[model samples]
Target: MAEPAVRYFFGQDGTKLAYRDLGVGRPLVLLHGFFSSGAHQWLHSGFAHTLAADGHRVIVPDLRAHGDSAAPHGAEHYPDDVLTDDAFALIDYLKLTTYNLGGYSLGARTVVRMLVRGAAPSRVIVAGQGLREVTGKGGTVARYLRHVFSHLGTFKPGTAEWKAEQWLTRTGGDPEALLHVLDSVLDTPADALTGIEVPMLVVVGDRDDRDGSALALSRTVSQGTHVVVPGDHTTAITAPELAETARTFLRDQ
Candidate 1:
């Protein structure tokens, strides 16, 4: 099927947000990672299609400052837990009383924040993140992104930072707005994991350890399962197994 047309909604702060709705069945909201849009992360990778095919009404949003969403350059536009707030706004706009939620990397982190703050999605898929990242203890991913943005032109060819910068350029990320989005990242307390009463799945690549241990993060959730797929943080999202694993988890009840 052709990709669903992008839709618009006003956020709690009145900023226009962009999202795509597809398939029909249980509502499933998937958030993309930082510096990426729902189209680039989900549509391009064919991930949303697989899940939608499996009896889900997939809703993927371009988080504020990413994709077709409104990207305000001023720092004042972003408040603490802004992404989390945006997710809640989308849910409210869709009038989804029951649904499944999932995301990757920065998006995955946002999913954890939503749960700790009391989002009751029937099932959840947190990929490419670990406990330390959620608890604000893992600064590796944030630090790396900051380094790339802060020293934009300084990275040498073939270096990791340069590679990231190249990817950011390809994604058409707004550097100024994304920096502010970074400042809004919320760190959930380890103790808050107890409050998540629904089934949660933590999927991490076998070679990925950027945000620490995915297994450890899964163990913290009362009803969590950890799945190890192939590839690292960057490559993992494109892995076919990633989509299959998520589809299976979401279908298992």
Candidate 2:
């Protein structure tokens, strides 16, 4: 397997973004979760290697403000579903008319956004997330963003907010810009997710009921499949079964 190499591309607004390219076959784009970049969430977890070894050319982008990408700390840099737009830009840059795309957590939410925006990836995998995030009011995301941006270092250790701070700090992400992204994604209409024609695999941890059922979400789409893996939200992302599930779906005979 070829080692992943760092590459650069420009977003719609000219913000330079970074991505890792590996292997040599079908292009598989993997988006990482909130506060986590492509390197830690996908590469470090061995998920990227798994896909690459399965006869795929893996493309993992470090979303703006989350990795080696330019982290602009302003609202203007983040429009509604802008992260998805960035992904689309990468796809366009690669000139790939069809490819496989997937993500976990925030990246999972992004898959839904891409579907709504009419991206026609040949296959999609949404892991570690559930229905509410894709179709609910999204109040919790806004509240969490507000808490992080407002309080910053004030959150005590051992709490979720404090842990969140650490994750953002690892990539030198700007909290204000993240809040803008939250605002942009929250504006997406809940009803837009239902009749998507794209074939999707919604894989969530069986115990991750906090965000509603992944099965329920998949059933709404015309060509969706649901897979229940072990563990909760966080643990599910690193589960070996996730890579296996993805390999099976993307390589079906």
Candidate 3:
């Protein structure tokens, strides 16, 4: 199917954000990962199509500083929990009272924050993220990204930081904007996970643990289940089974 047309809305701070709406059924908002856009994470990987085809009005937003969203170089635009704020702003702009929400990687982290801050989605999908990712101090990925950005063009070819830089360059990411976004990240305390009463699906790849324990995260939630697919941190997002498993989980009553 053809990709949906991009739509625009103003965030709480007046930053213009973009999202794609497709299919037609129960509302399902899916957020993309860091250093990736909605089109790359969802559309190109066939994840959104699978969910949309399974009777969902798939809504994927490109977070601020990623994809088509405004990438302000100023630090003032990236307040603490800024991504969470943007997510809530989008939900409010759409006027969605009841909806299923899910996200991958950074997106998943944002979903957890939204829940902690009082988002009442009917169901939630947290994929490619783990407990430490949600609760750990100064996130591993955040630190790693900081290092990569801080030393861009100085790393050896085989180093992980170099690889990350190459990926960022290929994706046309804005280092300054992304660094500010990373700086705005606020860790969610472990105790806050218990307050999320809605059913939650913790989907992670068997070989992926860059952030932390996925099973541990699932166990923390009041009503959560775990599903391990085949792939690592990066490849997991493209795994076809990931989408299929998510569909089954979200479809269950």
TM-scores, each model vs. reference? 0.96, 0.92, 0.97
In model 3, how large is the Cα lDDT of residue 221?
A: 93
lDDT string for model 2 (1-253, tens) is: 4446789999999999999998888899999987678998898878889989899999999987888888787778888778899999999998988688899988888878888888888888988766767665446765876788789989989998898888778767778767776666644454677768778899988778643567777877788898987778777778898889989999972
Superposed model 1: Cα runs more than 4 Å off: 210-212
| 1-253 per-residue lDDT for model 1 (tens digits) | 6989999998888999999999999999999998989998898889999988889999999999999999998777899999999999999998999999999988999999999888999999999998888888888778888878999989899999999899888888888899999999989888988778889999998888753478888888899899988898878888999999999899898
Residue-by-residue lDDT tens digits, candidate 3, 1-253: 8989999998888999999999999999998999999999999999999999999999999999999999999899999999999999998999999899999989999999999999999999999888878897527677778989988999999888888999999999999999999888888999989888999999998888643478888899999898999899888988999999989988896
Give the residue spans of candidate 2 off by over 4 A: 1-3, 187-190
Candidates by TM-score, descending order: 3, 1, 2
Clash count of each predicted structure: 0, 0, 0
Record all residue pairs in model 2 with backbone atoms less than 3 Å apart, i.e. clashing: none
C-alpha lDDT score of every prediction, in listed order: 0.90, 0.82, 0.91
Clashes by residue pair, model 3: none
How would you order the candidates by lDDT, starting with the best? 3, 1, 2
Ten-residue segment with the worst summed lDDT in candidate 3?
Answer: 136-145
